[model samples]
Target: MSGVTAGVLDEAIKKAAIAWVSVEDGPAYALWCMPAENSIVVVSGPGEQYAPGLAEATRATVRLRGDHGGLILVVDAVVDRLEPGGDEWNELAPQLATKRLNASGTADDLAARWAGSGCAVVRLTPAADSVVGAPDLPADSAAQPPRETPARVETRRPFRLHRVRKR
Candidate 1:
């Protein structure tokens, strides 16, 4: 890959808080990840962000946004799952837990929970040569309709303060 493409990929992945991953032509799922040693690490499953098929997927498409919040880099990633108590997992899980926003417990606590709770920590190594950026971006928007969900806001009565009228 050229230096320019590499720079774009690095900048996009480092600056974005979330990445959109698609497996087997499925809908892109937005997942939180931490960039590590030229790869992205993501924790998924119950009690974490949903990334169906990613645990077993061998390859995936990863899209990242630029500083302006637009799709900046699209690349193919080689997926590899890490063993729960393996060296790589042990090294990365704590670090990723620390970076997890709105986490309820300490990094060690979360990592331990993940170890026992069937959470999968997968690495996404970008295929540097497959990166698409800049002038090579597709012309049409890739937006998709929202998926169905059971969640909805309930209507409620509003409360207001009562005041005496001046004469």
Candidate 2:
């Protein structure tokens, strides 16, 4: 649907990681990284139902990559998606009153919950960093072996020549 391929996914994951690391506070919750032969998939779902689906997708991608010895990184964020009107909200209110915030805890809880939901469960063999990157051969890899050109054969047919004097 998103025209996502293995290379695209890997690039996306790298971008997300770069962005996440750039933030002063870092990501609020864990991020999923799945690498494939030609791409990688990165999913960011911080809420209840959404997180599970995203995690599952990430795990599946990782599994696929693993078959080819790809690499994946799952960064666990320690926060949970707060339900609009759930018991957790009530607890959060009291903690807010006490000036005790659990941003990391909240994220970790969500990650743990998603993990328990049977999401992000994939056994993949990690690949070297070099394996992940542009699919094109490096420009300096060496001039491409000279390509062989097919020989061309000429076939001539005889034609009668007629000479006409100007009238």
Candidate 3:
């Protein structure tokens, strides 16, 4: 089955975080990460909806997910519960700061940051040119080939035995 795209998964994760923060009344935002690729995408609404809360939550989630492995987060709504400099907001600022500063780095550097946060990173994109053409296989090989027969089978019936003595 086709798996969800990294971008799609990132959007979903952000929406979930927004919902978690009860920012349904505000605008929606999304955050996603390609852990293997050590990449993150942040999308905010046209308005200033869940941008703040979504941003904060996204960072925390990224850090947490990074601990186990890389993750994607999406925030669906905006919440105005806290100011950017407030204690709670400041506490979460580091993550956002990291996101901003590391925004343009190599995947390896991104992976390092994720690892520093005690998480793993990955990239989920299928390698380009992987499906450019049909793969060649040996002519002798068959797809869904027939199964081989067993060498021997046991029977329930018993056979009479004759013994011969050797001098």
Candidate 4:
């Protein structure tokens, strides 16, 4: 069952690690992305990542999860919203703050706080020419897949301290 070109969907959206982002009607986010030149730069609001349609979405559906998370590439994007000192935010906010993860700051202080405020930098670009996907509604919840892998330890038994006799 091959055929998923465009360099295997841009090498599975640059070896995914987080990009569940689904919009065109909201809800379905996981952000923390960066792999432009074909688009996939992300970032949302508050504390970081909540992707509620970056100031009027254009279209989206990028799910690229793998590395045990399964689902490898399901793009169909074309959304843009990179305001913050333009020029593609001076070239993708320091490569999306060096593909942040534990960053807390640095990478030019997260491209200067996402070019100084509001935190957006969205850009998906993948609509057709491959990566066929554009159906909608996939903010999946209640996912099940853990039937048990051996690792349980709860012996229980320890709690005795009753003292109150003097009124």
Candidate 5:
């Protein structure tokens, strides 16, 4: 696999629909996010799924996937919260909500509620030259790769089928 570069990472962030993220060495989880000018914007709180405390997080790691399954971009991030109804939230909320394009009328309401005291909009900015490259595979990663299974071969005639009565 080729090592990730700044441009490649940015492009992956732009094209990816969801990201696997974690903060402060916490368990990694999937989150829906949007790529902003210089950072990735993620939302979490009471109503959202995988709500990590990004506001209080100092460090974060985000993994973005490409169209192909094996294309992964891993970046170390700095997590921060955008002020409720502030410039950053206002700018990114619409972009973030684009993922739920079929929400119809409910999107605005959801956005408003998320912008309220209940939820938080977190920005995960890529740290300066902090690209955490592809993860090293364990020794057993390919232990089961495409090996033939041993099986007994039946040389007798095909077994007869018995038809059961309809209940």
Candidate 6:
């Protein structure tokens, strides 16, 4: 990476509270993440956001948004799964939990439940030469249809202030 590109990537990764990660060239999913040890840490599973194919992917694309929520930088990243209870997990998990906002419990408590809850902690190490910023970003909006979900607004008759009809 050039000095400029490296600086931009580092700043973006550090300031971004959420990143759009596309696993195995699939659709990008917005996930909460933290910058740690020059890499990005993201957790996904039950009780957390879902990042399809992230748990098994060897590589992925990470897109960081600017202050205005527009795409600022795109980079290819090496995906590594942190084994629960291992050295890496022990080191990073608490940090991630601390970064998590509106969490129900203390950092230690949250990190403790992660393994049992089947959460996958993934580290995305940005590739040195894959940084693509402003001028090089694609012209396309990169929009996609929303994924299927069970929740929906229920259809019902509108309620009237009075039951009787006016003559």
Please give, for residues 1-167, the per-residue lDDT of candidate 5 as tens digits: 23556777777777766888877666667787877877788877875766566667877878777778553666788888887678877777766766654555565577887776477778888875767555532233222234344774559976769865878
Candidate 4 clashes between residue pairs 3 or more apart in a chain or in different chains: none
Worst ten in a row by lDDT for model 5 = 136-145
lDDT of model 5, residue 70: 53
**Ordering by lDDT:** 6, 1, 5, 4, 2, 3
TM-score of each: 0.87, 0.21, 0.21, 0.28, 0.71, 0.88
Q: Pairs clashing in candidate 5?
A: none
Best lDDT goes to which candidate? 6
Answer with 2 or 4, whichever has the higher lDDT. Answer: 4
Which whole-number lDDT from 0 to 100 does residue 36 have in model 2?
27
> Of the candidates numbered 1 and 6, which has the greater TM-score value?
6
Q: Which tens-of-lDDT digit does each residue in 18-128 have in candidate 4?
A: 777767755566666878776678877766777776647788777776567666557668888887877888877887888787988678788787656777777788865
Candidate 1: tens digits of C-alpha lDDT, residues 36-85: 87889999988999999999999999999877888877899999998978
Candidate lDDT values, in order? 0.88, 0.33, 0.32, 0.70, 0.70, 0.88
Q: Looking at candidate 3, what is the lDDT of residue 19?
A: 23
On residues 2-61, what C-alpha lDDT tens digit does candidate 2 reach at each position? 223445445444443221111122222233433323333232333321233433321221
| lDDT, model 5, position 39 | 79
Each prediction's number of clashing residue pairs: 0, 21, 23, 0, 0, 0
* Candidate 5 structure, TM-score to reference: 0.71
lDDT of 6 by residue, 1-167 (tens): 53336778888988878999997758899898998867799999988888989999999999999888899888899999999899999999999999888899999899989988888999999997888888888899989988777886679988889788779
The positional error of residue 93 in candidate 6, measured at the CA in angstroms, is 0.3
Candidate 4: stretches off by over 4 Å:
1-18, 21-31, 34-38, 42-61, 64-90, 93-95, 98-105, 109-124, 128-142, 146-160, 163-167
Q: TM-score: which candidate is best?
A: 6
Residues 17-85 of candidate 3 have per-residue lDDT tens digits of 222222334432234421212233333323212344443342322221222333322222222222433
After superposition, candidate 2 runs with Cα above 4 Å error: 1-105, 121-126, 129-167
